[model samples]
Target: MRIMLIGRWGKTHALAKALAASRDVELYSLMDKKNTGIASLSAHYELGNIKDLSVIQKFVEKHRIDMLFVVPEMSLARGITDYFNEKGIPAVGPSEFCTKLEGDKGFVRNLMKENHIDHYPDFHVFSDKKEAVEFIRNYSRPFAVKPSGITEGDGVKVMGIQLINKQEAMDYVEQIFDRSIGGMASVIIEEKIEGEEYTIQLFCDGKTVVPMPVVRDYKLLEEGESGLNTPGMGSVSYPNHLLPSLSKNNFDESVVIMERILDVLKEKYGEKYNGFLSGQFMLTEQGIRVVEINVRPGDSEILNIIPILQTDFMDICRAMANEKLDEIKISFAEKSTVCIYAVPEGFPTPSGKVQIHIDRKRFEKPGIHLFQSCFEAGESLYEPSPRLFAVTGTGDSLEEAREKCLEGLSGIRGKNIFYRKDIGTRDLAERYMKKYDLPGV
Candidate 1:
């Protein structure tokens, strides 16, 4: 099978690694920008804007590509899948209209309310700054303020964490209206559901849904869960496929909610949802509450889960393309996985790019993998805008995985590079459990 993978990020690098491992697969890549790691792995590499259908169409025709593995949500939002599928090329992703589940927060909130999907948080969408401020001022409880559109996971501000008080929340709404944050001048004020957050990613073929291992993603930039929110800093998955603080019932409930949402997309909206769907859920006192829905795989989360997958990934992609996902039984290895990202010192605030150095030969050993998120600036020099790369480790136990991940990360040397030292550790897990008053493993 000849495949063309889209997008330019750490996830693209990870997917390229998985696809290149199959001898029958000829991997090709079309990146909006240059990514040396992805370029190195592809049989053919093209630099073109992924949102431009003309560029992609020409590439597909030139290569006679059999399958497209689209990664970025922005490309999906641009209707790349719909365009290519009409041309008889199978694209592994959701359509443009279907991407509203992640692209538009207001759409999702209303869908949940209209469909009576359980676990929907209290929320109100607003376009007027005055009305939004008035609503937040009178609300008695803490809430979260979010841009109605995608902000690459940095637009949300929760009360008591990002925003200190109601006044701050109101100020944020005003800022959103003035600045048009998240590419829109609208805001979503949602009742904050406080708990430990975890991600549930499922593969869908417009009918069948296969769930992957549950992953806990750390969004905060600093240790002890302090600092600004990033796309992701690190993530962890256990052998049991459930976090220590999460119950099996809650885990299953999260999957059921995703399935329900997919059903609504098909029945009510006439949109058959395909590709990867991830529900970011919180295990609150009231059971499971969904934080948001993602149309693509989570960045750091995918890094951990893909390494432990026991089944052939190419087969899964083929099944998704053919809408025969139910024909295959998916499975994963009984192993714990850990992924930690290394970023520049002044991340989320934006600083000058720092030079990065890595010894690729050192990672030939077992249980250690490296995926690049940075770009090459010069000979033997790399630069990181936010995250540079990720080091993943797998083992029979989480502790062993954490140790190996740290050991693998040691080979990556860069001035002012930072990574959390406590990811996939017992201390961090216990701290989170205590903070939420949840029972530990």
Candidate 2:
């Protein structure tokens, strides 16, 4: 089968490696833009724009592409899958209509409320800053202030980095509505539920849903969970695919909630949903409160889960296209995985010129997978781009995998390069373990 992946960055790199091992699968990546690892991983790729429907259509015809894995949410939001369906091309991704569950938070919140989904939170959306200020002024402690649209992971502000007091909340409201960040015409103030945060990734064909390993991604840049939130610093998952702080029942129930939402989408749109849908959940005393839905795979989270997948990824994609996900067997290895990303010393902030030296042999070591991101491949090694890259380690235990990743990252020698050392550490896992025994406060 001829398969084409449409995306860039580390997530695309990780997806490429996962499907590289499949039989009878000729893989191609469509990177509209130049990025790290593109020069190395994709031998057969179109240098044109990934967002342009014509570029993808031309590549599909020239390569006789049988299946497509549209990786980025942006592309999906722009109706990539809808066009593919029109062309009789099979793809694994949600349609533009489905992206409303992701792109427009207000729509999703209302959908959940109308459907009586258990994960919906108390929230209010406002287009006027005066009404927003007046509403939040008298509101109680511990609330989330968020822009209605994307801010490259900088949109939502809660008790992040530090507790979000009312005054800081006032400032965030001004930043979005007053400053028009991410072109926000509206803002959402949500009841900030306190708890551990994690992401639940699922594979779907608009009917049968298959759940991947539940992964807990760390947003804080510091090891001790201190520091500003980057796109994502690192992530970890156990062999069971459930965090210690989360219960199996909670995981299953959350899946039920998500499945129902998909059912509603299918019924409402009268279209079948096919693709990866991830629910960012905060495990609170009330249950799994879904914070957001990533229309595509999570970045660092995918790096953690792919290594432990026992089933062929292409098989799932094919199943999704064929509407036979339920028939296809889904399985994962009884192993733990850790993903750690390396970025500029002050990542999410631009870094000036800096050459990075990588031990290519480190990627060849047992149980190691390297997904290069911002850095581009050099004649000798690699030169730091902006985001650098990520290394994933798989082992019998999370701690061991973390050590393996840390050891692999230690091989990248450069100046002004930084990564969190605390990811996948036993010390941090112990804290979540304590949460398992704590009564819901």
Candidate 3:
């Protein structure tokens, strides 16, 4: 089967590696605004972003592509699948109807309540900043200032760090009113629950779902949750696809939540919701509460989850195409995976320019995998991408896996290149583990 993967920088490099080891499947090509990972792939690749439906349709028709798999938020939010269906080509990804889950966090929170899905905290949804400001000034309890629509990653400020005193929160609320930042006119004042957060990802075909490994993705740029949030920094998947301290009951509840939401999405929307459905949840003293959901695959999280998969990547794609997700079997090895992202010195903000060089031979070693995001190379070593590359390490234990990642990252040479030292480490993961053991119940 000829498969065209629609992603700028995801498991493109890793998928290329898997396809090379498989039979009867061809990596048709890739189209991304940047050629970071696409440039390194063995198959043909074109440079174009996942925007503009006309551009994608023309490319698919030109190649006579049999199947299409997309992984970007913008393209999916714009209804790429609906466009592909009209053109008679089978596409895999959330449709315009399904993307509302991620595109509008406020909507999902209400949907959960309407469906009687428990664990959602009491919240107020409002459009005007004046309304939110009034609530913040009067409400005594600490809460999170969040945007009702998509923030990409910004726009949400927690109570302690980002939201300092009541005055600072009022200022943040004013910022939300500004239409320039993601055009977020509405905001949600969510009750901020104290707990540790982990993401549960499942593969769904309109009717059934195959749960992939549960992984934790770090958003903080610094070691101790200090720094502005980007889409993601890195992630870790422990043995058995669950964390050390998370109880079996909590894990099972998350699965049931996903199943119930899947049913609701299929029933609420006429079209079947396909592709990745991720629930970013926090395990708190009150119980497990979902933060939000992403219709597409989590960017950095995919680094660890895809590498150790025993299922053929193409098989999953094919099953998704025919809406036969139940037929596809998923399994993860006992080995743990640690994924690290290397970014330009100015990551969350000003991403300065620098040249990044890596030894392909060093990356070829066992347990080390690299996926390029956005680094440009020239005769004299020119500018670098904001986010350069991702390095992954796999081992029997989390510590060994993390060490492999750190050692492999050393081989990546660049100026103004920095990565979080604490991501996926035992100490950092344990910090969240301790939250579950808190005394206040």
Candidate 4:
């Protein structure tokens, strides 16, 4: 399996590491701005952005990259995947048009309204602060202001009543402008849906779509979901909650929204437009409403779902690349797994290098998988950095998994290190599992 994975750095780093252990898999090349610690494993390294199609073409030909696995950077990833597909290379990703469903919030909102795919109240798009203020004045407070682009939960800010003042809203718009360029200045302001949120990830080879076990992610930095929003702090999936309801779960509405969204994509975009797909949903009194769509894999969510995947990850990718997904049957682990993300203090930005010491033996019990993240040193001693590594634990129940994850992470010692202590807990996972009312503690 020769695969060309494209992303910024950290994502590519994790992808290469996950695929390296496969005996049949060979990482052909990696295209990124800098070395994401994948140079040691990748057969060839192309040091440049994916926007350079000329360089991408040369690298693909030189290394014979069989398939392209695009990580999160969707705007660029979508464009690169589109370029490769146009060149007649076997690629697995949504088409540029389908990706726009995620790239442009305006487009998505319009689609949802047109299709009557569940609604979360009214939303307005703004290019100027004055018009935005007028719209807010005409309506309610406590709204959600989001950048049309930049998914993975970035560019989303939920304002409370007090924060909805005109000056604060203008400041936020200015911040969005600073982060955006070109016509990206447009922002999506919507009525904030009140309720718990959940993430539903789907795998599609363009046609037969399989929804992964629903996983819950803690988007905030601290407990009670109060703090600055990072990409993803941690995540866990409660299979117990999902088993009862492909039928009767409260989240059945979420599944409906996902199916509806996929239907729209297949109908509007071609069924051959394949790759990973994700749906973010909110469960409210009105039912589950679509929050956003992600065209590629969601990192923290993937960590939770992958263990349950009984099928071979490489085989599925190969089948997608070969256009034989119909012939492949995917299965998942009957047991449960939990994944916890650990980061250094002042993280989501550069902090100084820190040292991490771990008592490997203490947490090396059965059903534990440790994934290395922002570690910079050797196997024995993990030299500290902004992010260190992820510790995942698996057991018969969510509680057991939480215990293992907590214990495993406790073994590691590092200064300026911080992690959500509530990962895998019942209360933490309950909000996400609510829709699927199987059995709860």
Runs in model 4 with CA error above 4 Å? Answer: 8-18, 21-23, 29-47, 75-78, 161-166, 178-183, 241-253, 269-272, 357-365, 375-387, 429-440
Q: Which stretches of candidate 1 lie above 4 Å from their native place?
A: none
What is the Cα-based lDDT of residue 154 in candidate 3?
Answer: 57
Full ranking by lDDT: 1, 2, 3, 4
Q: Could you give candidate 4's per-residue lDDT for residues 308-404 as a string of tens digits?
A: 6667777777676666777988777766667777888886666766677767786558766555555444444444334566777777887787788
Number of the candidate with higher lDDT, 2 or 4: 2
Please tell me which model should have the higher TM-score, number 1 or number 2: 1
Mind giving the per-residue lDDT tens digits that candidate 1 earns over 1-441?
A: 889999889988988988888758999999866789899999999988888888988999999999999999888999999988888989999999999998899999899889889787889999888999999989987789999988877889999888988888888898898888987878999998988899999999999999999999999988988878888899999999998888788888889999999999999889998899989999898878889999998998999988987778898998998889999989999899999999888887766667777888768889999998877778756766468889999999999999989998999887888899989889999998999999977
Q: Indicate whether candidate 1 or candidate 3 has the larger lDDT.
A: 1
Tens digits of lDDT, candidate 2, 1-441? 778888877888888887777776777878865565654555587677777888888998888888889987777878988988887988889998998777788888888898788686789999898889888898875678878775555567775544357777787787787788756588888987867888889998877899988898888777777667677888988888887777888889888888888988888768677888888988777767889877888888888888888888888888888889889789988888899988877666666655777888988988888887764445434444446789999988887898899889988888778898888877777776565443321
Question: For candidate 3, lDDT tens digit of each residue in 1-441?
Answer: 666777665555555556555666666655555455565553556766567787777778777788787777677888888888677787878888888888877788888999999878778888777888999889888888887776665567888867778898888778778753445578888888877788888877778788777788888788776777776788888887777766667788998997887778778766678887888888888888988888876777778877798877777777876788777677778889999888777776755556667888878789988887764556325343446788999999988899989988999897778898798666776666665573221
What's model 1's overall lDDT?
0.89
Clashing pairs in 4: 250-435, 251-435, 308-333, 310-331, 310-332, 354-384
Candidate 4 deviates by what RMSD?
A: 3.7
After superposition, which runs of candidate 2 have C-alpha atoms over 4 Å from their true positions? 160-164, 178-180, 375-386, 433-441
TM-score of each model, paired residue for residue = 0.98, 0.93, 0.93, 0.85
Residue 7 shift from truth in candidate 3, angstroms:
2.3
